[model samples]
Target: MTQDYGFALARERGIALGPIGHRIVEENELTRVWEVRLAPGEELGFHIHYHPYYVVSLGGGDNEIETIFGKTIATQEPLGHTVYIDEKRAIHKLTNRSDQTYLSRLIEFKAVRWTYDDDPAQARPEAGEQTPEGYAAAFREILEHTADLPWEPKSLKGLYQKMLWRDEETGASIALIKFDKGVGIPNAHAHASNQFMYCLSGKYRYIPTGTTLVAGSFYCNPVGSVHGPTIADEATIFLEIYDGPHYPVQPPWYTDPKDAT
Candidate 1:
């Protein structure tokens, strides 16, 4: 008897190609993030995304996507807009329709776990059950704009955030953060989970690494790794994607905004 594979079989027949105007900015056990920039007429060649993912527009504009089935989707996205693709099945290609360069960030989840066995009962539990609560559903956001979300102050000075999603079970969260120019934390800190930062705009320096990150830069601070005292040279905007609750060691100069006199 021949085994039947659904989209997986079809995807095998689709064209396989490298990303267009995109580069692997960061990759780890949980995610692969891509930094993409397409000039007018440039395109991402035919490809299929097997995993759930999110696309965050840095400089939104018009674009056209053509699927293997010949369906075309025309989209006009705005800056800071985010779109989630849930378990995508189609093989597609993207074309930049506008004259200006199109910039965006693509984050793909690497959460699926499978076990091979002849008996169905031996199979592992559903993906959601084995992982931390909400981790399985984190990629389901259809579309959202960070500017429309409310900001919450962190323990650090000049830092504020707008949370995009938080996994209750794992305590992991995705958020948009803003740092006021010339403001910073005075002491280094570490978190319980790995932290990934993608700079959307402005400038800042991570003191320990001595790395000055700017727009389009990506950094991953592994769990237990001590890092900045981040100082903002300009009003900086960035995204923080982390695994597990953000339990950062309190810095010496940290002051809760709520306690301000």
Candidate 2:
């Protein structure tokens, strides 16, 4: 697909570089480009994202990153000095191991529901506008103001800037999610949109399908594919990218039957 409005804006306003620097390579309907930088002794610990990402180090020293599941999975410095991991399809962390700063570039594609999979009768052109509870409600307005939260609780899951980015205004949404140690979301459900999942840290036992995923693995669930109750030990995070405005499936538990259905 041609790079259009989304890609252009990513280049114009997306984080290209920082104490670590960054730049957007391209942004289109399916993918976006990004550049990253890290200062000496800097470490970007374990985090998550929804879209699968391809990354390459542009310059600098090595960094450290670790994922804590039942065990700790650490990345040696400069592992992707030239190679990039499809993060949307996998989960891991980035850190600067060397005394000097490091730099990396990535072009990631947000997951989207395919045209053929959705039920034609129910898939209205404006379906995205209808909010699904499990998806969007999880972070409502929280994404914009959230800063680095303490890790002690271990029960909480959150997203970081390097992994997932969301812009409600432009119809772009990405989720690098974490299933905190021993925690799982509610029962299985499907969304109106297609979804992509990647393992960044730890392991997961997804209910219904019984799929176990580790770091570097990716999973795609077509729209309406019922799967969830994601459970993990040690915080597990992953990226999910999709077309906007994603609505969540109203669970049966809602007080109002109308809301549930």
Candidate 3:
């Protein structure tokens, strides 16, 4: 947590493994995060990255990862579900396991060379409120927003994102997102920080599990979880937030489908 750019044992292995659609969204000298999207029926050919990743399912669709022997590995669904993949010899490919089409979004968190703990201490209960006091504000708003319109993911139509608030001084970010009905974001990829999201609209069929993440649900995608391209019956809206300045750029690796193995 010192925030220094000193080298660590992790730096010895440069670049990462993954397919073409994979790309970085945020990066700095110290840490970096990549965002990858996969459409329904699309596959992120087998690859690997030398970092821990947190996969955040934005909307509809199932996420499936398989090993070289065609054995099942990791799977996930939206409504805030997450999965972790280490950047060691974790070789696998991602696909939308659902019959429905959707967009999958992933944020990969890569730390700098040095290791440090940033763990937050456990919270104690407060006396009065039914729910935690800090979360009460969001809980109350959820009731107000549920009855609102156009909630579902579509290929086209409705607003995509709305920034709710931000604390530049503290590096805290928050926003509201609406995915069109019957559509998804994209495939599994990596990024640099822990991500949190909550659903506040129509239900979305989660990837990998084919479950539904509707209003009043929240999820967290830690460090590195190669998540999915989500999907939904109609437009679904949710809150998207993350801790960033994720990680720095990495050297390119091979991504050809034929040569991925």
Model 1 earns a TM-score of: 0.48
TM-score of each: 0.48, 0.37, 0.38
Instruction: Give lDDT for model 3.
Output: 0.52
Point out where model 1 deviates above 4 Å.
1-50, 53-142, 248-261
Predicted candidate 2 versus true structure: per-residue lDDT over 1-261, tens digit per residue: 431212233235442322212566445555665657678766554334444465554456545554322233444435234444542311235666677667655655444322211223223246658654444322233243223543222222331223345544434456556555777656777765545566777788887678888888766554476788767856677766543334465564343432221
RMSD of each: 11.6, 18.9, 17.2
Supply the global lDDT for candidate 1. Answer: 0.68
Error of 2 at 76 (Å): 30
Q: For residues 137-233, could you state the per-residue lDDT of candidate 3 as single tens digits?
A: 2222222343354343222344355545443433445566786688664455444556677788887765766757788777666557656556777
| Ranking according to lDDT, highest score first | 1, 3, 2
Which candidate should be chosen as best, given TM-score against the real structure?
1
For model 2, state the Cα shift of residue 192 in Å: 2.2
Q: What shift in Å separates residue 25 of candidate 1 from its native position after superposition?
A: 21
Ranking by TM-score: 1, 3, 2
